[model samples]
Target: MRAALALLLLVAAGTAGAQMYKWKDAKGLTHYSDTPPPASARQAEVKNFNSAPGADLPALLAEVARSHPVVLYTAADCAACAEGRALLQARGIPYSEKTVSTADDHAVLKKAGSPGQLPLLLVGQNKQIGFETATWDGLLSSAGYPASSALPPGYRHPPVGSAAPRRPSAAERERQAQEAARAAAEEAARGKRPPPPANAPPDFQF
Candidate 1:
């Protein structure tokens, strides 16, 4: 038993001495070899594991987001928009969605360089007008996002547009107050009860 154990330890020591070389060619493809790579190859720092190109994908992707934020422009009742959203969510991409519901929203979309297309995805200044899984995947891969779902379970993204309460701007608040007053006056002219304030909380009687 002692002799067999000694032989196993010798084999293990030999295996540990085996050298592996890693390098990248001019075209930026990673190569791994047991033999030394060519002098022209860009030798990568030796690591225990075979490191692929973009081995530090998560950190690189985070840096990309800081420099080139992702934005998804969507609209309600749009199937394609839902699919595009699902794709981003499945890839664990952090993005902000701008809903094209109001005229102002449409204007914002246009200024983002979309040609009135639905499901427009913005990667930094780069814009994708329509949702195509292959194309979107390729772009996301190039941006260094992981190619698979990495989201934690029950990870709720910010509620879809209109589902979350939004703070109104000062100008919007004033405009809403004016509209409310106009509505109340119109209701009074009809001899009906005036409506509650626009921002009033619901009063439920059970």
Candidate 2:
């Protein structure tokens, strides 16, 4: 029940449009607490909502294109459509927007193999529809976006060198993690610092 409640709280914090709360426990483990966390623990867990979910992709790509070239196809007045534009602007991305407000616009989108999902982003040789966060992030990342938030700010992104691509192979990541862990453990043992938490029990640290 506690875990379920925590999950729901996390979801509501994002979906019901509430602020996010964060905290770090005694063992350097982070947690999201609805209430304020300790002040001196490096960082307390309390922050406002980043933004609404499901952004308009075309607009987002355009904003990213401020640093690159981006193309978009969109119609007017769709809620998702609005989000698409807002996202691009928020990220400071500049793009070429082709409004499909007329039959010719509709024909252009169809001829270009784009769906009628309003914000259709074309980054390089790729085309994506809807507000797929991972896909947008990947496309923008590939097209040289300078580390903008694809989603609202609270949504996490991967580290600089490590990208969380859409449908990344889990096994490959696991194997790499294992290899890194083994290397770290070996280094620690050679330096007489125990095993360096290689086989530390889950949830045992925090």
Candidate 3:
């Protein structure tokens, strides 16, 4: 009888230890949280605890950058994506932001896993889909990435149109024309012109 009582007592203690928590949010809305909320908050019932992604921000970015090509797969007009772009630009880090919105972007989305989520940050040969602040910060840091908000010196976006300037200044044009004329005159003086047709036969030798 004593052994059975001890066993029952152990089961009761275990159940008590696994109690659910409840709390209220600032909105006066009562909520449940696994971890301690602010002063006004209380613990919530965590149906099942999950191992959250925890990473060292800086180290994560360094490692992630090396193995993964930073691809910010974001949709157009996405505030997070825009902020993300600004963040990357500040760091002066090079990245290909595939803005998806139109049909073309949709095609890219299909390949990347459409019907998913936006602001999809990829790195370290692995693509992390979703909006997890901790995970992203860790990945960026691991990749040795500069602070996302740091600006690169002398950064300028190339203007649209021809990459090389097509219009030359008047001075430049005249200079080139003069050079060409001088070169032609030198060729003529060198007597490098072809001979008359009468002396142009293949059988004729110089």
Candidate 4:
């Protein structure tokens, strides 16, 4: 009976979605079964990863994305940023990146809740300042991302950073537009608009 039970457990371990318990008998023989071990035996749980709910994966990932959107703030020529980017790509995590290359970029990074740290990671409101692989992995796993990558082939992330996109609010947009128009009008009134150079397009207004 012991030999038969051990063989059965081995078979069960190969199958998807199989739940089994492992323990050693009084004789020190290892055994596994779908039922609980006897009180005298030591118990351990064995999980099968292959049978994890495939149908629910999409919904699970979507919920995580909604509740914890991943954002990475990086900069060019930074070794840490490069490593962090590679880690995210390897994990097939979908994330948005903000590159801090200019004054405007620095302002945007600050507004995103960092103390001007490069390679900062933001999961929803949770801030991780600096690139640490183990910490990043732990947080992402806790947030319910799959252990293996789920990205499809040929997936390309969009380009990073727009010169000061987050810094300009609607009011700022209107204010800047008004200022530009005022400057243009004043120049026109003073007839100070410089004449286009030779071969310049007629539509050119300086």
Candidate 5:
């Protein structure tokens, strides 16, 4: 038992030292490999297996996630969306959720080629329009996720966010307002003529 335990420790140490590279190609598809990314790769990142919290994820699961990241598009008060989310949770699939509850979110959904469908699932470049258990399972399987839960204990999916770009923060809004005010002040200082009065005749000049 002592010998076996030591051997396991040695293996774990070796695995922890392994390096992984993650990057996006020109087409914006993400890739992961043990080798350095090619010259064309963008947003390249290097990770040591055990360098950070939750970085000790199982080898196969980590590789699969990097190669085929999963995204779920959902809307509030939708039964199908709830079911879909439940399925992913039950399977312990790490994924990002995008809530589609606004016009901007709907536009993003349309851009993704959905005809306003709820509970859209995207596994890498492939997409599924609705929540069908078998279909979703099949897509996940094809993307290399395990048949059963393999998630590490205490692992949690990222917090859900809007499908559209997030609204500017208060500070950002303030900065923008100040810039606009400054521009207006500069224009006024330049004596730029104001528009003619709305009540004036069409032939009236400023």
Candidate 6:
């Protein structure tokens, strides 16, 4: 009887150690379960039940955030953008900011269905082109964010980044420069002129 009890306890301990998997499908749907995600699932993450807490975010807030991530798009020298950011901060909504400052950034914004609009807010699939306190509040509430601040003390949102793809690191930039220099030297050796910039007008001489 003692040996049988010990075996049952071991089985229980093993069951308790099962990890959870969180992932997004090709359709952009998020899923969470103890079982492993499908091979096709993107951004899959295994969460250990016994892991120490990092951010200590509230359970409800974390759940809501996982289901409906928030993103805000802003531009420099825009008053509305500042106000929108302030509103989100006041509400303790964890969100990432995308700054639209370059042509590439603007192109990405347009692709996201914004016609070069500033202060755009995205809550899951919902889009708000402009900032309005009531509208923004409604969207957050609809997305299951708490009405009042639930963010932990000292918690800070992610830093703002450009809407364009991430810029290469310094090492990558140096490597590219060296490659360009080598190519230029090779072209000069062959008595050939390097191509002009892509944006150069057809009539513009190299």
- Which candidate wins on lDDT? 5
Instruction: Summarize candidate 6's per-residue lDDT along 43-159 as a digit string, tens digits.
Output: 866433332335445888877765566778899899999999999999998777789988999997887668988888987667899889999999999999988899887566655
Give per-residue CA lDDT, model 4, range 21-73, as digits (tens): 56688888898643334557743433222233342225566557545656788
Instruction: Give the per-residue lDDT digits (tens) of candidate 2, residues 1-206.
Output: 33345446545643232223465777888876322244334445333332435433344443443223445666667676577666666665544456676565666676555656657776644677776667776777787775654444434221111011123389966865676666666665667634438677865542
Per-candidate local distance difference test: 0.62, 0.52, 0.49, 0.65, 0.75, 0.73
Could you tell me the lDDT of residue 139 within candidate 5? 99
| Candidate 5 lDDT, 91-124, residue by residue in tens | 9887777889889999988876578988999876
Regions of model 6 farther than 4 Å from truth: 1-53, 169-206
The predicted structure with the larger lDDT, 2 or 4, is 4
TM-score of each: 0.49, 0.38, 0.39, 0.51, 0.60, 0.59
Q: For each candidate, how many residue pairs have backbone atoms clashing (under 3 Å)?
A: 0, 9, 25, 0, 0, 0
Tens-digit per-residue lDDT, 1-206, candidate 1: 33345444543443232223467999999986433345467744332221233322245544665444566889889999999999998888756566887776777677667768898887754678889999998888777677875544543343344212245689976875676666656655666556677777798222
Cα lDDT over the full model 6 = 0.73
lDDT (10s digit) by residue, model 3, range 140-186: 77766665543234333211111111356899768756766666567
Q: Which portions of model 2 show Cα errors greater than 4 Å?
A: 1-68, 149-206
Greater-TM-score candidate between 1 and 5:
5
Worst 10 residues of 1 by lDDT: 47-56
Model 3 collision count: 25
Clashing pairs in 2: 22-45, 56-83, 56-84, 62-93, 62-94, 63-93, 63-94, 64-93, 66-94
RMSD of each: 26.8, 18.3, 30.5, 26.9, 20.5, 21.2
Better of 3 and 4 by TM-score: 4
Error of 4 at 6 (Å): 68
